[model samples]
Target: MRVGRGAREDRADARDIEWPPSARSPGPAGRAGAARALAAAGASRHRARDFAWPGAHGAEAGVSGCGRRNILLVIFDSLGEGALASMADALPVLSGLRREALRFAAAYAPSPEGGPARASLFTGLDIPVHGVWTDGVALPERETTVAQRLAACGWRTWLVGRRHLAGVSNWTTEHARPFEYAHLDWAHGPLHRSRQNAYLAWLQDRAPAAYAEIFPTQANADDTDCPDWQRAAMSALPDALSFNRWVGARSCELLASHGRDGPFFGIAGFVIGETMGAAPRQSSPCEALQERALRQADAALGDILRQLERSGLAETTALVVTAARGSVAEADTDAPMQESAIRVPLMIRSPGLAAGTVAQAVSTIDVAATLYALSRVPPPRRLQGAPLLATGPGSVGRGWALSRLRRDHGWKTALRHGRWKLVVSHGDPDAGVQPGFSLFDLREDPEESRDLAADQAHQGMLETMIDLMIDARVAMEDRTEPRIASF
Candidate 1:
């Protein structure tokens, strides 16, 4: 019963902490009715459509049958493509997956922040459309998620770790929309003080010694006062009790229990790489910390994949590995529109798809469309993303990848066209300044060192890119419920 040191003493203290049973059980279904009530309340204003049940669509081109396929989506927070490539040697499992899976070198997140980026990935909508433009904003309950869609289509959906679709200011519990996840191991971050955080609860039950060491005072103590990197370095928790490992174990448990029941859509989200936890060293450079977190994540991923194989669900499952945003280092930069801030590692290993690298630009939103395709469900009309599996290697993923940042000061948008990247910033309107722009030919300047916005010779290209940016924004306008017939 004693999983960690000082388990006996910690058990005495655990009695004083308030732990919710729902944290260790299946998610509540009561939200489904609440969702209907909210919809009815706003029916006159919004006119949301009813949920469309999925029918048997024809099989995808490369896939064998029309049966629904299992989906395993693993997301690492703030993991940049550059970081993954730089530390490939240290990540054996992930590197091996990269070689065996369909690697997308030019994949980009829809937003550079966790909330908006994850919203786009789940809803296949742009930041403006979904309305989760930044970290603190809540995803509107009316907006349907991929998990809800799949659940309606007879697929079991589960999520483990880091569902930041809504605000997490309250420490008692995290929020969940209608039927978003059948089972959830909710933890906004490793060090969050939520009593409903399943990761923390698991530590209390299974590894009380480690829990007592990490949180010496109260079970819900706010340990976030210390910087994440410093806390990670100073922590006494072992690799076995790390957050990512707990997420992986929960995912494997779900797989083993539900693999034979029906097709399932599961997400295992790892936050270590972003928060700089689970490192072996007490203190290290930023790069070393990130690399160590990645290695730990790799080990956890190996466990999940091996569990998939053991359950005989490997071939029937479409495995997706990606990041919610880009590198943590981007936080220190002036502008987050850089490639290192938005570009992320993306790979997919499906039953019939050939393993190869794709250089075509793709957005994280495409992952939602691809999941719908794999499940034999028609993508909703409002989805702005196209399935990547339908596109060839040379063909563009979504024609271009777009990233957006919205703050109190202004709005910053970046558009990546064939070889060019255009970044436009609209300053606060009251300041009375015109929008400024920057152009970079990624082929020539991959690091985006030189800005061509002021160059006279590249004026023509800049104008063209500006037009594309305008067109893209116009195209992304909300179309969730179009006026079928002007009444």
Candidate 2:
């Protein structure tokens, strides 16, 4: 790995890097709160509004959008619109954040599976090009990740939770550099507690008492045979002390302690839908509990946000909260193009961006690009996404979203171009799915209940969308080709 600014681990860990400011001042709010607190306290003389970033009055403010030095990217593992809508009553903190942030109404995941979806989010590339198709696969070394790019731009980056983008097999790869990699399997639900190794270590560092009370038993447990995939209800530990509360609390601590050398970029992933399945599935008591998991996630988010405000970094940190993908069926495996996986909630709250809603079509691929753009860091030229907050002249973005799914039952390619959507299936007739064409007018049938493939009146519309899908596929193939053939 290339040597970066601070002291770094030869093994690619940011935590191993020490900050001089943190060593000098140990603030009470967090373990290393002095670093950021020094900056915040020293910069308090400049009176600025929420959108007016200090020392960035004209061109810098216009280009970078704000003077925010820290980025907090929060991901809820498996939360869909339906689940969020059901728990609206329980998510007051998130609801308040939604009102304070810029909400994307049509943000979609690049893939349905968590690993592949995270690959897209990190690389800003689709599944076919990135070559990370599912949970155990790593993003190819040839592709540079967002973390590497941000580090090159002088950001102190740390990943505090689930890192599905890097496969265990590719840990030796040099692409994911200048960022600490910490992975955690949530303590409840269908997740194997054995996979919560990273979290246990973090708990020992941050909350020794909680770790002492909930170890060995968890270490010796056989949670691998989870049948329902839902987490067991959390124990009596207060929300701040619970095992499920670690990532959020840890992120809060980081937000308070970061930016001694420069701005920090941290991602924290939470377990939300431990067992909620895809659409047309029956809802039971267990499913309700799964929804409660979202509430817990929201509470965790609140904890982080409250800390942000308390640390006086509230106006300067760009916060984004989203998900990898959500399941619609009882099982975790599902077609990527399904609405349950595609429809996700994305909210960005930063200093310059106004609190409003964007109704245009957008993809999770846009996430990395947007973050880089907001930080005023130049992204790699080949990344395949538009900045979600692109403004001024020539700020238009990709008006379509493409996804693919190769499942045990069948495989299909889909694209949402404008108001039309096309799903081209390759097999699975036994599962009531066939190799044929299915079209939907998303404006009239957002749920895709009506298939317009056979409607001759819209034959031309169907043809154009099919061609659009084909052209998109060709573009992906061009990017992914080993021989470098034109699409």
Best by lDDT: 1
Q: How would you encode candidate 2's per-residue C-alpha lDDT over 141-248 as one tens digit per residue?
A: 778777676665566777655565654321222123434332223332213343444554555676677555544344323223323312242343456644446777
Off by over 4 Å in 1: 1-65, 170-172, 219-224, 227-230, 233-236, 273-289, 328-330, 429-434
Indicate the TM-score of model 1.
0.81
Task: Output the TM-score of candidate 2.
Answer: 0.71
lDDT of 1 by residue, 1-487 (tens): 0011222333322221111222212124222222233223322222121123143232223223468789999998778888788888989999998899999888999887777899999888888888897766888877778888777666788999887787665353557766768898888656676778888888889887766666676633433353554465424467777778888889999999984767899999888543432221112111212555567779999999999999999989999999988874634466677887789999999999899988766789878877877777766656666677765575423356789887442478998856778898877667675678888978779989999777665654565566556656665667566456978
In model 2, residue pairs whose N, Cα or C atoms come closer than 3 Å (at least 3 residues apart or on different chains), thus clashing, are 188-231, 189-230, 189-231, 190-229, 277-328, 277-329, 278-328, 278-329, 279-328
lDDT of 2: 0.59
